[model samples]
Target chain A: EDKVVQSPLSLVVHEGDTVTLNCSYEVTNFRSLLWYKQEKKAPTFLFMLTSSGIEKKSGRLSSILDKKELSSILNITATQTGDSAIYLCAVEVLFGFGNEKLTFGTGTRLTIIP
Target chain B: EPEVTQTPSHQVTQMGQEVILRCVPISNHLYFYWYRQILGQKVEFLVSFYNNEISEKSEIFDDQFSVERPDGSNFTLKIRSTKLEDSAMYFCASSEAGGLAGMETQYFGPGTRLLVL
Candidate 1:
């Protein structure tokens, strides 16, 4: 079965501090990796990593995938109270030629204190 | 900027009662999915639908659960008999399937919180 694991299940940091969340996975057919931010209801997309050693970035947040290590890391720089939320990592797998599904990690809860 | 939309931001029902959650996926998307997250638990996939039929479903999607795209636009999930365990935040998502390989992103709805009491 495809599995995804995230480290540092919970983290607390003061405003303006930087934090990194980690995720690793094991899957039969690797397709892509996606990151999401969840505050209350549904999760919102953050970034999708398909190639190794490539970094994808958005304002105040960036993520890189290391295929060789079967892992990815999300970095939040100059964090603010608004950045406090659950970070989720999901691995998209193509079981066969066209079959696909996403296996998600438990997620890391981040709290930024002001 | 289109998004998936779900109805009944919150629903309260009793055990053994039937309930249906509705979703209106992105107007142009071809694939739809249903996921649920129990409080303090990771979100889980329940069912995936495409071309008006169910393409895949998880073990959690038993005989008590069913999905239908009854019309051209709305997608629905029906639970015949609700259990306490069925209480969770249910989300609906859509993606533009049949597109370039690995190029699609599944956009999610705000979700409907279901409470069974």
Candidate 2:
């Protein structure tokens, strides 16, 4: 079965701390890896990584894909209390007839303390 | 920024009852999708729709599930018969393109929580 596993299912960090969340997947016909920040109800778009080694960065968040190892990492620097939420990693793969689907991981719940 | 929107943030129903989840995808999006996440479980793909027809569906999308784009902007998912196991948070998503190999970003809606008793 296609699988996406996230490590350290839960993490607690203090403000100003830096943390890394890991995700690894084993699936057929990999297309891209996406990261999302799920706060109350929606899983807000974060970054989508398709190339290996080259990193995608936002204001304080960044992610990189490692196709060689079938893994990805999300890094959040200088975390704040508002960063407390479930970080999700979803792998997009091609389906039959040119369709696409996103296989999501259980997600890493991060709690940032002030 | 355009965002997908869903109705009935929460719903309560009895087993075997029918339920219809409503969604309004971003106006310019051409593709639509439905996903569900049971409590404490990972979000799962249910179906994808494009051009008023289903493009792809996962194994979980059985005979009990159906989708339709009644109007130009509204997409709907209907459950013929709800089951206790079917209670979950359903999310609607949309993308400007098919997200095939070109990598189109899919924007998701705030999900609707359903409970089957």
Candidate 3:
């Protein structure tokens, strides 16, 4: 079965600390890996990684994909209280000719302490 | 910035009743999808649509569910008969294209919370 697994289901860190969340997947027709941040509402797009070894960054957030390992990692630096949320990692799988659906991990809950 | 939009942020229905959830995807998007999350659970994919047809669907999307792009802008999901277990946060998402080479980002809307009694 196509599956996504995220480690350290929950974590608590003090403000300004750097955190790394992991996601591993095994799926057929692997397309791309994506990361999302979920607060009280729906998850918001963070980064999409396709090629391996190339890092995608947005301010304090960055992510990289390792196709050989079938995994990806999201790194958050200098975390703030506002950064506390559920970080979701998903893999896009193409089941048919041109259709894609994302299989998501259980999500890593990051709680930043003041 | 363009974003997907959903209506009736919250809905309540009795068991066995039908419910229709609506969404307006980004104007230029060619791929649309529906996903649901039961409280404290992972987001589960229900279906994906492209070229006005269902391209793929998950086992969770049984005969009880259907989707329609009734107009130029609206995409809807209908539940023939709601069950108490159907209560969840249904999210609507849209992407400009689908597949590995497209590099499309699926943007999600504020989900509609459905409560089945």
Candidate 4:
């Protein structure tokens, strides 16, 4: 079975602090790894990583994938209360017949304290 | 920006009742999918539709579940008979393509919260 595990299931950080969320996966025919932020309802896209050692960033948020280690990390710098949300990590795998499915992790619940 | 949209943000139905969840995927997109997330659980893929047919489906998608793209814009999932365990947040998503080498960015909808009593 394809599995994606995220570390530090829950975390609490103060405003202005930096935090790193971890995700590790064991999947066959791996195609891509994606990150999402879930606030109250649906999850919003964050970053998608395909190549190893390449970092994808947006403003204060950045993510990098390490294929050699079968792991990925999402870093948030200068965090604010608005950053509080459940961070989800999903791995996409090819299942033949030109089809793909996303296997997601349990997600990391991040709480930013003011 | 074009995003997927689902109807009946919340649906409450009795067990053994039938319900149809509707969705309108992003214009110009060719691929559509259905996913569900039970409370306090990970999101799970249910089915993937392309070219007006079902291209793939998970084991969770049984005979009781059916999907159809009846027209140019509307996609629907029909549950013949609901069960208590079927209560969940059903999400509709779409992408421009379906293969492994494509962009494969599946845009998701806000989801319909189904509660079976």
Question: Lowest-lDDT window of 10 residues in candidate 3 chain A?
Answer: A90-99
User: Which candidate do you rate higher for DockQ, 2 or 4?
Assistant: 4
Point out the higher-scoring one by DockQ: 1 or 2: 2
Highest lDDT against the true fold, candidate? 3
Native-referenced DockQ of model 1: 0.56
**Per-residue lDDT tens digits of candidate 2, residues A1-114?**
789999879999999999999999999989899999999888999999989999999999999999999999999999999999999999998877557889999999999999
Docking class of 1: medium
Task: Please report how far candidate 3 places residue B112 from its true position, in Å.
Answer: 0.5
After superposing all C-alphas onto the true structure, candidate 3 shows an RMSD in angstroms of: 0.9
Candidate 4: the clashing residue pairs are: none
What candidate 4 gets wrong by more than 4 Å, as runs, is none
**Candidate 3: which stretches are off by over 4 Å?**
none
By DockQ: ranked, best first: 3, 4, 2, 1
lDDT of 4 at B29: 86
For each candidate, what is the lDDT? 0.90, 0.93, 0.95, 0.93
Tell me the tens digit of each residue's lDDT in model 1 across A1-114: 779999889999999999999999999888889999999878999998999999999999999999999999999999999999999998877653455667789999999999
Better of 1 and 4 by TM-score: 4
Instruction: Report residue A75 deviation for candidate 4 (angstroms).
Output: 0.3
lDDT of 4 by residue, B1-117 (tens): 788999999999999999999999999888899999999999998999988899889999999999999999999999999999999999998888876558678889999999999
The best candidate in terms of DockQ? 3
Query: Best candidate per TM-score, number?
Result: 3
Score residue B7 of candidate 1 by CA lDDT: 95
